[model samples]
Structures are given as structure tokens and as C-alpha cells.
Target: MPTSRELREVKAHFYSLAGFPNVIGCVDGTHIPIQSCGGDEAELFRNRKGYFSINVQVVCDANLLIRDIDARWHGSAHDSTVYHNSFLRARLDNNEIDGHLLGDSAYPCGRYMMTPILNTSTNAERLYNVAQIKTRNTIERTFGVWKRRFPCLSQKLRIKLEHTLAVIIATAVLHNIAIQQNDTVSIDNSPEEDIISAESNMQPLTSEGNHYRRLLLEQYFM
Candidate 1:
């Protein structure tokens, strides 16, 4: 979670990219492959892509700095489920944060969590989607850079699940340090799969969220 001052800075950075206002960060889930900890509960780690992994929920600013992360969920868990059960969600629900997060359609829209509109019948809505997506892409880029810097995240972690979780956090911390130090790594041409997918059992959008999104569109995009 960002401080009030940091939130303002992040919002300005996001708005500069695509004119998306009041966006504090971009949120998304990325799967980290892991070796099976064979047991009756081992099947719980198998994801939709038929791989054993952990579903890590991350929130990053426009500078590609990770602000928050939840790497406790198994790969089988849906992105929405991970978010709903996250401490960040509770903070947003309690109005602890200052700005909204731009997530994909997989996340439920709320006063603090803005998701893309499914049906856009107007130019304003379309523009809103474009701006939102452009600003939201920072998380994807952050994931790409983080994984490229530490190949262990892209490849299967051969350690125990407990240790794997610690390793994930450690790498994320080191990644942030690199970003702070202005360290650059050449991104190769390796194909990074799109991890953002629709949830079959989606969470219902809140009325407040719908109103907030509409206000943003009419105020800035229209």
C-alpha cells in the first residue's frame, strides 16, 4: 500500500500515460511454476493450464515498482478469489487507500477497484477502456522484467512450498532494489503468455463502482 503522497504521485504518473485519472496502481495475477510437493493436497496446486504453481497477486505503480503482493494462494485458486481474500482488499473496503486500482475484467469493479466495461456502446466507454488498459499494462511489464531478471520465477521452483514462497518475496524485494538503482536488463524475444484470464465464477460488480466508473468516463473521457 502506498502512502497518501505516493498515491498522488502514482496517480499522476498513470494519468500521464493515457489520461486515466485517480489510478494508484495496476493489479494482476501471475503464476509461478513449482515442483509438486506430493501429497493428497498436491492436486490443489495444479492450475487451469495443467501446471503446478502458485498464483501471485501483484500491484505495481507506473514506475514498475511493486507496491503490494500476495503469493500465498495456490495455482488452482482463481485471481478474484485471491484478491477478495487479500489484505489489500480489506484496506480498500475500509477506505484505507486513496485511489482506485486498474485491474482487468477478471476483477470485480468497485469504488477502489476499476475493471474494464464488458459492453461499450459509446465512444467514451471505448476510450475509457483504452486508457485503462494502457495504464494497467505496467503490472504486466513489471512481471516481465521481474521474471527476466530472476529466471527462477519463470522456471519451476525446485524447493519446498514454504521456501518457495519466501524466495518469491525475496526476489520481489531485490527486483524493487534494481528498479530503485536504475538497473536495466535486456528483455529477450521470449514469448510471455498472457496470464490475465476471465473467471467463470465472477464476482458481481458493485453499484458504487459502476457509478464511479461512469463518473470518470463522463468527467475525463467524454
Candidate 2:
């Protein structure tokens, strides 16, 4: 978790990119391929893509440094489900964090989680979507960098499920360290074949969330 001062700095950096205010981090999920568990629960590891893997939820700052990660969910789990069950969600719900996270439409919009608007008829709405997408793309780029740094994440991990989970979290820690040391990999020429598309099963926003988004648009995007 970031301190209050650090969260403020992250929000400023994100706002500078697209004028999206109060954004502390970008959140998303990625599937990590792994060998089958070889049991009744083996099928549980198979995702919609027909691959056995783990659905890893990650939150990254504007600097592409990972701030949070949950690698315990199976590949078949919905991105929103994983987030709802995460410790980060609890912290956000408790107002322990001062800023919101930018996620795709698959997440339920709330005071702490902002998702893209589905229907846009006004120029303010359009601009809001554009800024949201631009700001939210950091998580995607962070995944690319992390996977490129550790090929094991991109490839199938032939280890036990317990070990696989440990490896996933360990790599994320190493990724942050690499970023801090200015030791980053170039993902410019990376292929897009491995990139997972954003889930389209959009979740409904809370009444408070809808009102908050509207306020944001009127205050900033307008």
C-alpha cells in the first residue's frame, strides 16, 4: 500500500497524462499459463481461452510500478470476482486509500474504482472515456514489462500449484525492484498474441458511483 503522500504523487502523475484526477493506480487481470493440477479441480484451472492458468489481478502506478497483486485465483475466475475478494478491495472499502483505481468496464464502478462509461452521447462523456482509457493503460503496459522480464510467467509453469503461486508473487516483487533500479525491458517490439482482451461482462455501478463519475466529468472533462 502507498502512503498518503505517495498516493498524492501518483494521482498528480496520472492527472498530468490525461487530466483524470484522483487516480492512484490502474487495475487489471492477466492469465498466467500453468500445467494442469491433474485432479477434479484441474478443469477449474482452464480459462475461457481453453488454457490452464491462473488469473492474476494486478494494480500498478503511473510509473508502471506494481502496487498490489493477487495471484491466488484460478484462470476461470472473473476479473471482478478476484478483485471483490482481494485484500486491496477491503482497504479501499474502508477508505484506507485516499485515491481511486482505474479499471475496465468488467469491474463494478464505485467510489474507489472507476470504469469506462458504456454509453456516451455528450462530448464530456467522450472525453472522459478517452482520458480513462489513456490513464488505465498503465496496467496493460506493466503486465507486458513484468512478463517480458520473467519469461516463466508468459510460458507454462510446470511446477506444483503451490509453487506456481509463489513464483507469480515473487516475480512481481522482482519487477518492482527492477523498475526502482531503472532496469527495465523494452516492450516496443513485443508481439500482441499473448495479450488478453479486456472482459466485456460489464458490472453495474452503484448509485454513489454513478453520481461520482458524473461529478468527475462535470468538474474536469467538461
Using Cα atoms with residue i matched to residue i, what is each candidate's TM-score against the true structure? Answer: 0.95, 0.95
CA-lDDT, candidates in order:
0.88, 0.89
Question: Candidate 1, which segments miss by more than 4 Å at Cα?
Answer: 188-191, 194-196, 199-203
What's the lDDT for residue 54 in model 1? 96
Look at candidate 2 and tell me the lDDT of residue 179: 95
Q: Which ten residues in a row have the lowest lDDT in candidate 1?
A: 188-197
lDDT at 222 for candidate 1? 90
Error of 1 at 73 (Å): 0.4
Using TM-score as the measure, the top candidate is: 2
- Against the true structure, candidate 1 reaches a TM-score of 0.95
Instruction: Itemize residue pairs with steric clashes in candidate 1.
Output: none
Cα distance off (Å), candidate 2, residue 27: 0.3
Clashing pairs in 2: none
